[model samples]
Target chain A: MTRPSPKIGVYGFTGCAGDQLMILNCEDQLVDLFGATEIRSFVMAKSDNHEAELDVALVEGSISTEAQLKHLKDIRERSKVLIAIGTCACWGGPQAMKLGDGKFEERYKKVYGNAKITVSKAIEGQPLDAFVKVDMKIPGCPIDKQEFLKSVSKLVAGKHPYLLKSPVCLECKWKENKCLLLDGKFCAGPLTKGGCGAVCPSHNLPCVGCWGPTDDLNVSAEYDLLKEKGFVPEEIITKIRKFGGSGVMELVKNLEKKEAKK
Target chain B: MMILKMKKEDLPAFLESAKEWGELWGPTTKDGKTSYAKVDSLSQMDLKATRTVIPPKKFLYPPRFTMFDFDEEGFVERTGDVPKRILFGLHPCDVHGILIMDKLFLETYKDPYYAERREKTLLLGHSCIPDDKCMCFATNTDFVAEGFDLFFTDLKMFYLVWVGSSKGHDLVRMRADLFSRNLDKNDILNYTEYRKWKTAQFKAKIDLTGMPDIFELGYNSPIWDELGEKCLSCGQCSMVCPTCNCYNVVDEVDLGTAEGTRDRFWDSCMFREYSVVAGGHNFRDKRADRLRLWYTHKLQAFIGEFGKPACVGCGRCVATCPVDINVATVSTALKEQEVGK
Candidate 1:
């Protein structure tokens, strides 16, 4: 008896499309992917794609326009499992960073001042979860490929994906690498999630908190440490707010008060 | 193990004798900096030298070597066979990095390209002749360890060599009377003293004792943003790092045919495109995170893995980085923070 292959589709939105490229990056497992299941749609990888009800739909990019909102709702309706891939889809990626500093009209003016812009009306770009419920999220600017394939293959086999959140600091420990802390190398491995295999540190650099803060973290303590280093409260908040943006703004107030003491 | 003291006059003979075993590649002076490349004459081998600009890992894992040739039709071909070559003149820090990479390639996915080359090759280590740029002592990698067949220490006219494996003994056996004939406690102690002298020469100016406290506090330090403004994102800091092994795997078509190879080449997380997704989503999209990620991995996360920082403290990143983002300066700033805290 032959079993029916699952229908899977991949979609993208308004971004550099590097995350999807990262998936295509798995050259070895790609053939295995084609062999395992029926790829219903993947705009960048293939031209011939179906848009019917999908067993699993992997989406990247954010909701920047009304068209994207309608498309996301349709995806949510049709797909059994909707996995948001990359930070923009999972958490508002880079574009979401400029929330408060200015209005869209002003910022747009600054970039394309007073031009009759008829491209797409701005609608505060947000993660997919904002428009439609996300079953699971594979975070990162572009999620790590090994984990991505494992999830896709698992889904194809009718298994749940194993999401990792052990923190980049844990992988650092696993490698038996020296703690940059002892050398006074201020690092956020404790706060940020792992799965990148500590690539930054291996290059004699520190973690920039790109993987996003772990679920269980002491953000305040790190704040205190920075203050002790004589760093300004505004500077520290702006740095972390790069990835976490609004998620981190609330924490900035406490930091500023601490800096006021001295 | 037998050892013989080769007279300074017989250095060329020693070089020629070693060639019978295999092609010996050591430190050759290029533009006055010690770089590992093929050499024919003994004078070309900077016997008394500074550290090589690049680690010998490049020989096994070339910066952009092809992994294999593959085709659109799935005709997978692998270039797993590596030539038998001898790599000499590795500093202790570099030797340590080689051992770490051995764990990466030999253990996990069984990287045939790295492992195949590594298995067929011999490793030779040399002690450091202290220089202002050298920082092995900062990471405690100044002393020789395993991963080398022959370990050479410069003792003025004569070289103190330690044969680690069978290969080392074979090299020593080839030269009957040139190397020291017998090993005694005194000779071992003399070498130990030389290593200690080398350590004193480096004398890591900043103590690494209070790293955790300093780093924990420096987590929100303003130095990163200040430095981020100057960064070019060229990834030079990552390129010259001995332990930095991030790579990008790519598929290419062979000639005009569908037959091509999938290969993994060195990649840096610093590049803006490193974390970008096809959907235009970038998690660490900010320049600060890129800068922060580099230091965090080296300082905090690397410590969690290997119980040592990933950086060899070679200052190559500082030298090569277009922005001059020096880890030493960062560490000093953290030290001051620890005191302030």
Candidate 2:
């Protein structure tokens, strides 16, 4: 007997929608995906979007507004497996850096200039997990196509998708590119999670921590490392906070406390 | 070795004739970085470049080398699909690096995949003039006396070619029109003098006279932690190092299908996952431990086993590392520091 086709929805909130574009970038592989599962909703690709319950929901972007939060919770209730796609959905992305710096209001006012928006009320962008539980995450500035296919195929087969817990340093080694960090440029490959196939490093560019911190990253040690390398405390924190999200701020707090005690 | 001379103007024609050898690969500029690539024409080759961003080792040992295809009915071995090729204009250090890798791949348990590529490929070595970043002189790999099919040293208006092997002699004979019997005694004298002058040009130096002893005694040195603090554990050193042949074998099964493949890709000792074993225990858990292991392997363990350190001092690692965590600096630290009580 043929297995029932999986019902899936792809949604976006407050990000570049680059992850959605990446899914479409899998042009040849998307045919296989289309055959294997029923794509119920993907506004980026098709117009016929369904509102019914889904077996799997791949969400892109972060929750930055009350309206987006409501929509995210609704999607969570309807989907059995909710996978956060992209750094925006997974770790709040670049927008979350202001929150980490404790200058969100200042930055927000600078942009909007005291004008009250009548549309959706804006809150600091947050990872999908802040509002509802995300079953899995595919982290990247824009999610990698190969990784997306791997996870989607696993979900289609009713199996749990596995991701490497190691940092980008692992893949960077495989590619054998010169380390950007060794040139005295700050690279976060050792701290950020592996899965993007170390793309930026392969091109001899520093990893901007777009994939967020790895599971076992020693943030305090990394902080000390930057300091030892002659980077100012503020400079180090700001560099990490580029894509580090609020978790980096917590690590900074812990590091400051440890330093004070010493 | 049969010594021959070829004029600079005849290089295009000579390279064009070299097509009979197989696919010609030499350093070419791409994306503002010089890397070894397939040269379709004379203009595509940049033999004058100091060092390529990536070495010629990839031709012999590909990044993703497939070992076999498997199913429930055993496996089908991935036989020699290697094309006949010539890796031209390889720097002396890179040539030396290939020789070092041969110790591992060509000896003991022979890797058929690597062996096939090795057998099919011919190395055309080139003499290099060292820049500030080079330490090949300290590593004694600056000038290769052997282990190449042909070695070319640029001599102003001409190229002094040393046909080192029977294969090289065959190629030279095939393109005899490009060669000249007019090569005089002074040309040979100039070649020797130029090599001596080129060797003296290297600025970076590391005294590896007591490396094994230093590495052994400096096991508990605080330098490892200091270096570790700066290291991103990105494995860029090993990746760019031509002699680094470490890899992980993985059996990747196609989703919803029984067919699978046994593939091997490059692995790094710097990675935390590299030391992780069964039951989820990582022996080299700390970043410092991993960094120490990498340095020890390159400078000590390999030397103890192979009678020579694995590094060829190509300066690729020095030039590529983002944090400027140089191998020479680490070696100097080990040599200068005394073992703490």
User: Chain A alone, TM-score for each of the models?
Assistant: 0.88, 0.93
Q: Model 1, range B1-341, lDDT digits (tens) per residue?
A: 33445555766786678788778788876544567777886767885666665667777787666666644355544664556777777778788878777776788688777877887778877667766766767776677557788877777666777677888778767876677566668777876787678777874475565566567777778766655544434354565677777876755432112344565666667665578787979877665677778877777777877687777666666544423465665677556642111
How would you encode candidate 2's per-residue C-alpha lDDT over A20-63 as one tens digit per residue? Answer: 99998989877878878898999999998998999999999989
Lowest-scoring 10 consecutive residues by lDDT in candidate 1 chain B?
B252-261
Task: State in Å the error of residue A95, model 2.
Answer: 3.9
Q: What stretches of model 1 exceed 4 Å from their correct place? A: A1-262, B1-8, B183-189, B254-256, B337-341
Candidate 2: residue A229 Cα off by (Å): 10
Q: Model 2 scores what on Cα lDDT? A: 0.80
* Candidate 2 chain B: worst-modelled 10 consecutive residues by lDDT: B250-259
Top candidate when judged by DockQ against the true structure: 2
- In model 1, the Cα lDDT at residue A84 comes to 86
Going through the candidates in order, what is the number of backbone clashes in each? 76, 12
